[model samples]
Target: MVSLPEELQAREAAARQRVEELQAEAAELAVRLERARAALSRLEITRETVMEVLADLSAAEVEAHDAPDPRETPAPHGIGVMAVPPWREGLVAGVLPDVYRDIVEIVADAPGPLQAKQIVPRIGLEATTAKIEGTRGKLKRLVERGWLDEDTPGRFTLARHEGDAGHVNSR
Candidate 1:
């Protein structure tokens, strides 16, 4: 026959052991939860970085698609031989590319003839040698296409036709 006090002591020891086991399990579960949270944070960062890179790539593709290739061969009949088309009576500056249109507008609005260095800054470009040279090339192309004139060397102005007035308007 077991005594009542002895039975009570035995039950108390079992309960203490169960409590210790439960506490150990809880500590291990907490570590696992922290590790999972850290992994989720890392994954979120990686996903955001990938999305940014993809967006940049998409923008670059659009720009490349919109920009005309300078080295492309001309089609028959001189239809597509040049990027800067020859100016006609009804032709407007809007027919040109974004950079070309901006250049024409700047030249048209200038009080006097402009040089490549003078035009570069007005077109929101940095005043670097490469930028100046590129602008010079565009200016020469415009001159050749009859959109502009080079009355003096390295100076550009809007071309004047016999009956075409207000050909280039500010937009």
Candidate 2:
């Protein structure tokens, strides 16, 4: 049989090899995680763009028709997914007040959830506490209107189908 000292050294070598393997695996996983995050960010932007286009088209259709079409429904949040809120299904700018429109735009462009104070700089508004509070209120209203989703108590992000107006009826 092998000596005890030799056996301990052999076990140590095996343990070291296992550790190296684990380290390599962890590195690979980290790379994959980063790639996934990038892809998700790109996809979110694409979704927002598509929703905006759809909303503009729907608004044009609504203007041309001069009558609400019963056949069309609000554009879905995703591929064949559930419908978004009615306000987001058309030209939000046409419907919402100017301040609300600015709020939506600011939140939509944010990379992640944004607090009201952070929004003031991006939207070119005053940075007073009252202004921040007002921003918070407006953000909350947008959430109520289905234009945004509150990621946390005081932070918000754009909803997936934010600007999606469902299919427009052909004239």
Candidate 3:
């Protein structure tokens, strides 16, 4: 039979051991969390670098190509290679790639400004964080190119060009 003092000592030891185990588990989880954060940072950097490279390539391609006849309707740009062009008179959303055209059409059709998260599902993409961020980038690019307006930060709407109220819908 164990004495009361021995039983208390044993219980204390077990509790200490359990605390140590919990500490070890917490340390491991912290390490894993740090690794995941680093990986996410690296992926974001890689994505930005790729987008820059693609934009540069698109610009080079546009410069190298011979100018098309002004009288002829321009062909729709290919997917994954086209840069958002600056909006101009007679420039319609049809000349943009499918994703960009859809974005423009969605904004144009919306009653008011829309957030990137709201646009994500409408663009047929899952409303994940990555997709929302990517869509936000595209929306920012459109605003830069004069295709869209960011009246309030993070909210987007079609750019209102004089005499081109129906241009976005022309696509």
Candidate 4:
């Protein structure tokens, strides 16, 4: 080692202090770098797990939501229950079959059960097995709902007269 004067000794001490400050700064930077790497890893894992969970939940929803309406039950009568079609014809004379519209028209003009067979031609409902039976099924529902009453075995007309409408209560 070369001999140094008193003035040079002070400069050498300052150089050692500067080296210590740089060492401390490097240590702090190393700690920050490790924390940043750990945070990045945690975010990657969280993103992958979230994607997997969403995929499973989507699959479950598809399985559960696909189903038919339970209210569409089979009609008790030989004919099946059909939807009450939207009424667009003039005068709200109650729910009547499209084919049986004429039958209702005739009855509204002159009230009575124009027999099942007689109603076919007038209402344009040809006396086919499916058509007749479906109409009969519809008649049964209307009767149950108090919109039609079986005056005789096969003869079904309107629910009841306005005066007797109160007596037509479901048992």
Candidate 5:
């Protein structure tokens, strides 16, 4: 027959081994959890970028083309394929009066005044009343301030980023 003390010792050893195995698994799981969190953070940033782009496009709806709807309704495609206006990305970022500083950052970061609807979620709108004209008014003011020169009636582009003091030195 097996001795009682030896049997108990073996059982205790088995339990200890099981604990070590569980500890190793826990450490690995911790690593995986950290990796997943990092991936999620990156995805949030991407989502925000996409939202920003979409918001810009929505805000610039005034420049919509006269093209007839290809479909009765637009189908939902995957990411990065949304219909955004290429022309009015500048207006999306902000107009000159309100967004001159912001525009400088966007211009410096981007290749040009791109269809930057990518920044919509990043630049979320706050609650405002009908009297409160935020970015839109700033853009109009910028045209008046000569911070932006009008490419067309609604479309305005920055005259110069710096040293202009919101006035056009020359036409």
Candidate 6:
């Protein structure tokens, strides 16, 4: 029979080897995670660009044919904000996709800063963790673009318009 001490040493070596393998796997995963995050950031920027182009086209169309709705609240720079619900179309409607604009409108109209969970029901999206995370990502982008403000981590409110220093709750 093999010696007990020799068997224990072999097992210890095997365990150490497993630990080293796991550490290597963890390092690989960390690199992959960074790559994924970078790709996502690029995608967000592309989406923002596409949205801006669409908004410009829409604004041109409006200026060419449609008379301004006196009932609609006009933005300071003439960027139209479309209605989210009770609010009139102004800036959010002009620049963002329906979902992103809705998110901004929800936060803009909220009595206080709102978390993703709190926003899901009002926005009528199904409450999934992925959906909530997507909402969080959009909110972060809006903050980066100066459309919304992160009141705290994972909580959002309307951003103050740079030109609207006196305008109350301009989104």
**Which candidate's TM-score is highest?**
3
C-alpha displacement of 64 in model 3, angstroms? 13
Per-residue lDDT of candidate 2, residues 45-72 (tens digit):
9999888887786676547756454234
Tens digits of per-residue lDDT, candidate 1, 1-171, equal 999999999999999999999999999999999999999999999889877875675467456745444234221233222456567555677767778889999998899999999999999999999999999999999998789999999999999988777768622
Q: Which segments of model 3 are wrong by more than 4 Å?
A: 1-82
**lDDT (Cα) of model 6:** 0.69
Computed on alpha carbons, the lDDT of every model, listed in order, comes to 0.81, 0.69, 0.85, 0.55, 0.50, 0.69
- How high a TM-score does candidate 3 get? 0.57
Kindly provide the TM-score of model 2 when superposed on the true structure, using C-alpha atoms.
0.44
- Assess the local accuracy of residue 77 in candidate 6 as a C-alpha lDDT between 0 and 100: 34
Clash pairs for candidate 4: none
What lDDT is reached at residue 43 by model 2?
94
Q: How well does each candidate superpose onto the true structure, as a TM-score? A: 0.52, 0.44, 0.57, 0.35, 0.39, 0.44
Candidate 4 or 1, higher TM-score: 1
> Model 6, residue 117: what's the lDDT?
88
Candidate order by TM-score, decreasing, is 3, 1, 6, 2, 5, 4
Give the Cα error of residue 128 in candidate 6, in Å: 1.2
lDDT of 3 by residue, 1-171 (tens): 999999999999999999999999999999999999999999999889889988897677557646653224544455554456667677788777678889999999999999999999999999999999999999999999899999999999999999988767674
Clashes of each: 0, 1, 0, 0, 9, 7
Q: After superposition, how far is residue 147 of candidate 1 from its true place, in Å?
A: 0.3
**Candidate closer to the true structure by TM-score (higher is better), 1 or 3:** 3
Regarding TM-score, does 1 or 6 come out ahead?
1
lDDT (Cα, tens digit) per residue for candidate 6, span 1-171? 889999999999999999999999999999999999999999999889878976886567556655555335433333334322222234334435567767877776788999988888788989899889888887777777667778688888887755543233333
C-alpha lDDT of residue 22 in model 3: 100
